[model samples]
Every structure is written in structure tokens, then in C-alpha cells.
Target: MQNDYMIVKEGGHSIALENGVFYNPKMKGLRDISVAFLKAAGAGGTTLLDSTSATGIRGIRYSDSGVAGLTFLDISEKASENTKRNVKRNNLEGISRVFNKSIQEFAHTREKFDIIDLDPFGSPMPYMNDIMKLSKGGTIMMVTATDTAVLCGAHPKACIKSYDSRPLHNELCKEVGIRILMGYAIRIAAKFNFGVDVLMVLSDMHYMRIFYRIRAGAENAVASMKEGGFGTYCNSCGSFGYSKGIAPVFQQACSNCGKRLEAFGPLYLGRLYDKRITGKILENLEDGNARKIIEVINDELDIPFFYNIPKITKLRRVGSASPAGIMSALGNAGHRCSPTQFSHSSIKTAAGIKAVEKALRSAKDFRLRAR
Candidate 1:
């Protein structure tokens, strides 16, 4: 089992697909999950866009799933060409179409899709608005963000810059990372007059994946998101921390022992896993390989509760902004990198979440005092 190849058999058919071209456990598992969801949704005859169509694996997978209108896009000529060949090889010639252009350019104003998927190597932040706009009626958004720093609350400033929310850099707020990521994706949907309801979410190591049911809403969602606060988990020994839901989480020391705790602010504070959806999807995973992986997911879900930590590296930061661009430059550039050095002052508190007005007022006061 080297990185040299993968043999992906098409369903129960005798067809076999092989090459070093596309191979990843997570990608394969997630593709199957999406299929299960669409089947359960009982929604057919819809459009799907694979914005970052790496090797066209996702696009092909979706087509094979029986999703009606599938559009696969890639910035590279070679990549898109490969996608075309794969589609033809799989006999999905008419069902799927591959595009040679950046998703930024291909996601057009005139085009509306039923589902738009963004699985960039890192952050999917910048393209949120575009994804929302392209989704017509009630489009489903499936976002995969592997850059945990912004989601986990590692770089608070960076999180705010990309997601318009803060991360709670702690162990307990595993839900915080997913929520923050969801909140940001929702807000992006909102801007295009798309309201968001998180249909399902699976927050795993190194990445946070979300499936959203998006609709129209401009004012309501934005007003709700402007509120902010710190997300906190125990800094000393990684214990269960709290989300004050009040702005200004870092103004005080740890509640447990007065020790300074690491916190991310106002990251969407809530539960991460959904048992119902996870169960349904797993139930549909009847195939041997898919069932095997689905069992692992089921086990993780069955656990009472677990730690939530952000997984981001220096290199991943750049991936969010431009995944296709980065990949072309370095085919496989990502490797384990050192975690960000945590400082004592980096810990935050929950008050930063309770009231944004108070937090902003404090910021203004700080500016005034400096003057």
C-alpha cells in the first residue's frame, strides 16, 4: 500500500479504476457519506458543483451517486483534462461536465446550482459568498476546512479576519470550532441572501466538515453573528472550560483555580455531533469498505464526549486562500509541522461572547485611553 495507486471499483459493477491519481481515506469516506445523504434526502435531479475538483474524484463520485446535474471545475488544464478522461472512463460522459478555470471564475452570476461543494486544501473562507450566490433556491453547501487554526481558535485575530468569528483555543469547545466554521459559512450564505441551517457536521482531526441547507436571508443572520465572545477551555491541564457567551472572555483568570486559561472568543458555542444524521448515514453504508469506515465514525460518535482541538499548521494557513494554486506549486507540500507556541496571555474568557456591545465599548474605551 504505497502512495503509488488506488483501485476504486465502481459500485457492484465489475469496473475497476486505478492509478496513483486520486487516493485518500477521508476523501473516499466523505464521498460515500454525501451519497448516503442525498439518497436519504430523496432529492434527485439537482445540480452539484465541485469547485476544487482535484482529480475530479468528487465530481465523478457525485455523478456515480446518481446526482443529476454535476459540474466539475479545476484551474489546471491538465487536471481538468484528467477529469474529462475519468468521466468518460466511468461512462459519465453526459451526466458530468469538467471545467478548466478557477472556481472563483467559474462560479458565475447567471449559473445557479442545487449544491455547491468547497473542499479546499485549507480554509474555504474566502469563497463562502460566491458559493452562496451560485446556489439557487435552497442549495446545499458542503464545506471541508482542514485548517484548524482558524476554526480551533488558535489565531484569534486570523479567525476574525477570515471567519468574522473567534476560536476558543481549548479542549472542551470541540463544538466551538465546528460552530465557528458553520457560522462563518452561514454568514457567507446570508450575504447572498442565503440563510443557513446546518444539516449535518462531522468534526474530525485535522479538518472540520459541514453540510448546510442554505436558503434566503439577508438581515436576520448577519445581526445574529455580529455578536462575539471568547471560547475557553482549561489551559493548565486541558479540562472542561465554559463559553460565557458574553463578550470579553480574557478579562479574567481561570474560574477553576485562577490560572490563566487558553480561550478563543465567541466561536459558535454549541454541540458538534448529531446522532440522528450520523446514524442514518452509517445505516446506508452497507458496502464492505464503506461499512468498515462508517463503523469507525459510529464508534467516535457513540463516545460520551471528547476533546475538541484545532489542527492547523503554518503551511495550511496559505491553503485556505488558494488551495488549487498552492497544490500546483507543490503537489504534496503538507507534512506535520510544529504547533503554534501558546503564550500565557493567549488564553481568553467567555464574557467576550455575552454582549458584543459591551466588548466593542471596551475596545473604544481602550482606544480612548491610549489617546
Candidate 2:
């Protein structure tokens, strides 16, 4: 019966998913992500963890990938039980362990792992420190942030409160949303004394997501957000774009139409991918052991936007055709924004410009309220 859910292979190896289980379509792509990391680690087996093993699929696959051991954990009792069942069925009862416990309880203890994964439902905001607890040197943390729309600078204050960082929206590509989320998550991780390196960044079907391969220690990993700057975006009719390395000027109105422009703050540029790791993973993707999933690895490696830009956290884009217009608008407003991302649904010129003016007024309200 298990075979029905699995694709059995030549050596009697198989891949299967539990029936009536929690499955995000991103789950499949997630599998690809884990495999890529494992291949990059350059070991037969590594001590890998699925911090929130939703269906235990990631943990199970880790064990199957010639990993020496796997620790599958889930707050959900059913998920832990499901992991146990799958491990048993796959004959991984020996090296794979599943636990139903609070991540905080686990974090309070001393346990170091080669990889500590956190794929929580929405934000991993709750578990940043616990993740640090389990990690030592060179620890790779696979983090997934699925609450993309909110984190994509759609709402500056909301994204800030939720992620504890800023978000920069990119309008040129549909992927700007997820990139914004990843950028925010990275900045937050940095504030906690660990540097977040994006191992993989991807977007698909209403979901903007990323897999961060994080390690402890803030130095040598990335440039601190202290020195970083922001990007402003324009939201005008058909001429959407972004500007960088400058302040937003309020007086900057849309050249297309002599109307005021909405200015989102200096959003960060998310650029923390490890170039060596990214390349090494692609180079050593194959051996006699795996021929089945090579295509996925190759496809991911070829993404155009995959680059290692350092020290930036998040970048925001509203919809300006040129970055100058965006920066000009923000600068004129006499409003100071963090280097992190910020965007409101407001636009540039006329109706959109009115929204921008309104946003400035609100920021003032927030500042006054703080006092």
C-alpha cells in the first residue's frame, strides 16, 4: 500500500507522501531545496533537522538522501506521529527521530546540529533565537517565509511590526513580493547576532518564497544594515521603476504628469546569497548516487536574479519608471525612512499622489503617537 504513494526505484529506494496530509505545492520545490543543500554540504550524510516538519516529508527525504541522521520535530502531535509512521514504513526507524515538543523547550537545551530548518506557517519571527540555540559554527538553517504578500512592502508599518525589519517591493518582476519578504527576514536575523545567507530564492503562483541558509556570527557573513541604504519606487501609470543609493524627495513629482508622487522609504536591497556555496552546489550536483533529480538542480541554478549582493536587507519598489523620481519624492517629503523596504498601495501623480501626501501625514501621526 505504501508503494501506491511512492515512486520506487531500481535499488528498492522510494519516495512517498502520506495520505490526507498537509501539502503545500511549494512542498515539492522545498524538497528540491533540501536536496540542493545536502549536495552542497559535500557529505554522505549530515545531521539535518526539520524544525517544523509539517508532514515529515522534508525530514524523511533528508534521511533518504544518504544523510547519517535526521531529527524531525513538530509542535503538532499528529505531525510527529505521521513522521514516526513514515520513518517506520521507510525503514528509517533507526536513524530518524521525531518529537512533538515546543521549539522553545528544545531551544533552551544544548543541542547542536549541522542543519536546523524552520519552515513555519507564516513568519519565523517567533523562533529566530531558538534557531540560533541549536546552531554552532557553519550551521545551515533552511528557513521558509510564506506570508509573502504582507512582507512584500505592501504595508510598511505592518511588515515592520511583523518581521521586525523593512521590505522592499520590486514591481518590474512579479517576484518583487517574495524578494521583499526574504530581505526583511534577513535583516531580522542579522539583528539577532546571526547572518542570514540566502541559499535559494524563488517565486511561483501567488507565493513569494525563499530558503535561507543561515549561520551564526554576524561578522564575515554580511555587511551590517547600519551602512546600507534604501531604494524608492514609483507607482505611476505604466512607468513603474525603482531608484537606489539615495533619499526619497517629496517634491519629486512624476515627469509623465505634473502631479505629486507617493514616496516609500529607502527599502533595502536583499543580496546575501553565498556565491561559492551557490556555485559549488551546482558544480557537484551529480554523482553515481543520484541521477533522478538532476534536472531540478540545473533549473534552479540558472535563475537570472540569483546573485550575491552583500550588506543590503530589503528593497522596496512602488511603481516608478525611474529610480530618480522615487528618490526625489522621498527626499522632498522631509521624512526619514530606514534602509529597509517600505511601500503603501499609494501611487504617483494625481489620485496616487494624494495617497502619497496622505501617507506622509500618517507617518507624522505615528511619530507623534510615539512621543
Candidate 3:
């Protein structure tokens, strides 16, 4: 049992991990980002709830960041005991509480949390309604979905069943996954006449995390619903376009190429991350990978899809061109271009596929001439 006391360092806090309780070292960047987000957003008057706390690392970290208070809730007695130990170990008895019961038990209770963090082992979809009920106006809810396949259209049926939205799998699959998750959250919150303002979203290494601020009222709910839309992608030409609203009509042929287009969505097509909050998060990040992720996110266009330069070059049978040179060429041609966080070699630009192909060919021709 002593071996279960393995100490783990995460963000600005340290905790002892239990044998059966989950504590992934790989998720350290996520924890650090959460901490930075809280600092930037100002966790005011918020009683934080780590709804799926296994080892209590997240709750303890939030408490250490001076959140008003936090409740560490877990269904496992082993995890509950470990949470108590970690709370005591960190000397945070005054502002921390441990509960060993299914989070659903709290649904009936009048008690509500200003911030409820759901980092479950799998899909958070099943618990969405109950958590929506537990949220009050102005509540901040954070959710993590590890079912990338379901959210990314690898399993279209499951994605539709779970999130009630169609997903796209391609170069922009990660962004589609994020949007699918966001669409689900918005719709779930709308059931309770609560609207969500997405604060931060991340798709890092096999999981997608989202933070939202809930606003109460039927009007806000309708406004949030309006953000839902669908994407039409042309497999033949790599051309894609999005139509706003739930009922979207897809053209029979691709606008750029005369090939049939495949449709994906009924998902959120709005902005993924708040620019101001992301800028602040970038300032607090110490890890290179996390900083780079945020930096790319900050630079990415609010558009739906990004084109992988390598894939584009391969499609054209031209020599590979640097992403930087392609972006520079596109920018010079009076088009907005930026690298996407989803793929390092990809660019999200207003330039059409034809324009991109031209840019790539021009860059290659210039390089050959110089040599």
C-alpha cells in the first residue's frame, strides 16, 4: 500500500497517487493550462467541483491557485481516501471537501457549483443533462472527451448517437471534433435554458477539453443554437464550405470542382478559443509544447478547415514547399493565412485550392531558378 503513495508533480501542486486511481503524467500540460486559464479568467465567487476526481490532482491544483473552495468527488472509496490524504498532505483542509459517491447523487441536492470540472474516463455525454441541471447562470463548466474516434467521424453512428452531431474526418478532423463537442455542450445547456460562451478549447494528444461560461435565459439559448451549422467537403478537390444553421443544403457538385461533395456537421462552427484568454494563457505557459499549441491556436483562422501543404503538394505532384513560403505567398496575394494547431504543415487560409496550387508551384519554380 505504501507504493500507492507515489508522489506526482502537476502544475503548481504535488499529490500522492493511489494504485487504482487514475493520474496520467501525459495530461500535465492540460492541468497547467487549466490553472493558467483560471488565473486569467478570474475564478470569482466560484465553488469548484472536481466531479470525477480520482487522485484529486486537479482539485488540489485549483485550490492551490486560490479558488474560493473545491469539492473532490469520486465514486471509488479508494480514490476518496486518497483525495483526503492529498488534501491533508497539501495542508488544504480549510478549503477542500471529499465526497465518495456518484456525481449524480448531487443532482437532486440544492447545492450547485460555480465551476464543475468533468474529466471522466470516457464520454461525458451521458452525464451532460445532470451537469446542466447542476449549473446556475454564470457557472463555468469544463469537460474532457477522450473518445476522439466518436467525435472525429471514425464512427459516425456513435458520434451522432453520443453528441447528436455529424463529424468530419480529414485534415480538419481535430477541429471538427472540438466543434462537435462544443455543439453538444451548447445543446445540452440549452435544454435548461442556459447558453454557453466557450472560453477555451483544446485538442491535445487524444483528448479534447473545453471550458464554457453558462448564461441563463431562453433568448441566450436560442442565440447559442444559431451557432450550429454544417460543413460540405469535396473529396475530389479538397474544397469545403460551411452553411450556417441546423438545416443546411449541400450542393450536388463541388463549387470549385464538378464532383459530388460529402457533408459533415450540424455542429458548432463558431470560434473555438477566446483570443484574449488564449493570449493570457500563452503568457503563463512554461512548457514548450503547450506554449506552441496555444500559439498556433492563437494564429489559426476562425474558419472551418485547413489544408495540409504536404497533402496539397502530393495531390498536385509538385515538389514540397515550405509552409512558411506558402503562407507568405498567400499573404502577398491579399489573402489571410495562418498555421493551424491541428497540423504543423497545414495552413488555414482564404485562398482557394487553385490559388494554393499556384503558390506551391511558384515557390518551387523560384527555388529551382535560384539553384
Could you say which candidate leads in lDDT?
3
Q: Per-residue CA lDDT of candidate 2, range 197-286, in tens? A: 565554444444455555567672355343233433334332233444334233466654444555443334445345555555555444
Report lDDT (Cα) of residue 358, candidate 1: 25
True-vs-predicted CA distance for residue 72, candidate 1, Å: 1.1
2 or 3, which is superior by lDDT?
Answer: 3
* Superior candidate under TM-score, 2 versus 3: 3
Worst 10 residues of 2 by lDDT: 306-315
All candidates: CA RMSD (Å): 14.1, 12.1, 3.0
**Sequence-dependent TM-score of model 2:** 0.62
Error of 3 at 344 (Å): 1.3
**In candidate 3, what are the lDDT values of residues 1-371, reduced to their tens digit?**
67647887776577888788888989988888888788777785569989899989898888745688888889999999999999998888988889998878877674778888999987999889888777899888889999999998899899988887778878778888888899989988989998889887888898999999999999999889888888888776677788777676667788776878888877887777788888888777886788888888887787777888877666555677899998888887888999887788888987778787667766666332220
Off by over 4 Å in 3: 366-371
TM-score of each: 0.67, 0.62, 0.94
lDDT per model, in order?
A: 0.56, 0.52, 0.83
Ranking by TM-score: 3, 1, 2
